[model samples]
Target: MNTRGQFLSSRLVNDSLISLFVVSTFPPFRISFQLRMWDWFQQYCPWVLQGISMVYGMIVRIRRKAYQREWLRPKHLSRPVVSVGNITVGGTGKTPFVIWLAHQLHAKGQRVAILSRGYGRQDPSKNLMVSDGKGHVKEWRVSGDEPTMIAQHCPWALVAVGPDRFRLGQWVLEQTPCDCFILDDGYQHLSLYRDLDLLLFDATDVKGLCGVLPAGRLREPLDSAKGAAAFIFTRSETLSSIQPVQTCIEKVIGQSINPIVLKMVPKQVRHLVTGEVQPLTFFSQRSLLVVSGIGNPRSFCDILTGCGLEVGEEIRFPDHCAYGQDEANLILEKIGQSDQDIVVTTEKDAVKLREWFSKDDPVWFVTTDLEFLAGEEHILGLLDRAGVV
Candidate 1:
């Protein structure tokens, strides 16, 4: 009516406030509102993280009492090593339980190698190998994403990487005819020597064991798993939901241990460019689309929406993400304009999107394992007391 109808109603209220600030900055609404503000600072800042987890649990009990009195010893390697790790950082599946403990010591014939301080390697200080147990000759950014997804699922098992894992376990036990050595994420790698440390966790991480790095999500503390001898509980489902987490780990390491539980599942959906093996009812109710970079993308979208599928959309990244090809053509143009139909991910993001997908790309990858709901033969008697049977 007046000055050009008041400049067309102030440009329609500044274009609806710039479309609600770009739909609240998209990308899964800014990664689920920055993970609900880091889960309300790890659950209402436990009494303000008890004075920074008591000066970060007193430097993790003085670097674990300087590797227990020896003022730092740990460094042997003439075989026997076994160490699958985790105390709480994320993804406590520890590379699918170190490819199910390297297929239970490569199905009895023994001889498995793993080692890995590789986490997202590029030139992680050079020491490579990535696989010599038969495949993946190197490159998941130089063997990193969980040691290239455990050397593409234990090709016989021998995945290596460096940053000094006790000199990369004396250079993959002098390069091969190896007899043991698993170690990926070796329980805080206190310089090496490990005839079994096996401490993994994540039946929902017990409130991220209350504080260490940046204030929670412990990297140490929980007495660094008190020199772990048992405790394996990954995303459990049964065995009486692990009896109040085995009475809260026997009142936090005051003894009473023996707890295993496992139950992971989703054992393989494959095909990231023709390895095939698809049918898990072709992902049940379809319309899927779940991407990852892992470190618990909500337990990989609640274990693929509890296997029935129907994810709709999710694309998290920041946790070892490397998928190049301009991030696979922006994740194939956001799953080709939505309404999904396919695109699952996580054999650690399908080993970094197999050189960025191509051969008729429909892309898939499920592969999870760990099933021993109630001490399955007590994890083969702790891998026969770590001597690898």
Candidate 2:
């Protein structure tokens, strides 16, 4: 080949390599690129995603019918099981709601056991105990971030982790006494029969209910939610925000279902290393280098902003991200030795980030609780109806 042609080829290869490095090394770039590609596909080849979603919807309906027809009988444990789940993929605040439910059960002197699929765990196939109703028995890496966070919040609740929640619940019953079981994210787990199914939806996500799977965020068609004992909308601060999603849900159910609305209120901010909790007001007006690796990062940021903290810089990572020293270094670089600037994250991320950050670092995490804005009595009424209380 000619010298000019060789030079041009080398330049093209180098440019491609540089572009790949930027996309892989930076989270923002990678996420933006992925979104752009998905948008292009949706705009040009809409049939492909729609066709896949149609097939997925059919499979969902068939599986649901199997359970209904007793072709696939659901196994029930001796104890009552209450499931907290969502129709959409993620970010429904299941962990916080689970924690809240556990606390309520604990108040009634009922021994509670939390059964989880332990998504994002290193060895999800193996059944593991996260907390034995006293404290954590395994690390976050083994138990998964959401389960670990639940265990941390509800130390008095026994937490079991595995793919098969029925088997996990059985094993827990054998090892220890439990008055009831809280199935974490078990909406689609038809293998186990639940006494009460609490289906959750993010009120802010109006567009999420558009379709199923590849075409949209929904895991199953809207009709699947009809089986839920009661529907709960999370992050519902205003009526206007909740109306659109609620209307869509009622339209599909062919009835006026007055859904329960829950506002995720920030409870406290605790130092990761010292374990000292500061009031949410302590961070008011302070500059924050916000770091989050959760399903609804925008919700987290909005909560921080609502607390009157200034988000000077923000870094978003994929949901259930396993933090490392390199990521910590990158965060520290963003902070850049500013006394007024501090790093803030969600409690879920804190579980994994603690390994890379220490007491000396200006790192803290926010803890949130579910506050019922509407239909608080509905939850209690459902619990009573299910005979779980």
TM-score of each: 0.33, 0.88
Clashing pairs in 2: none
Q: Write the per-residue lDDT of candidate 1 for residues 1-389, one digit (tens) a residue.
A: 11100111111322111211211122445644655654576578656645776787798779888988888898888888888888767677877778877887889888788878787677888788878887756777777788877777677778888888888778777766788888888788887888878887777556666556556666777766778877888888887766665666577778888888887888768888787887667778777777676677667667777777777766555577665665576667766767775888877777778877876878788876677877868878888976777
What is the model-wide C-alpha lDDT for candidate 2? 0.81
Question: What is the clash tally of candidate 1?
Answer: 0
* Model 2, C-alpha of 364: deviation from truth (Å): 1.7
Lowest summed lDDT across 10 adjacent residues in model 2 is found at: 2-11
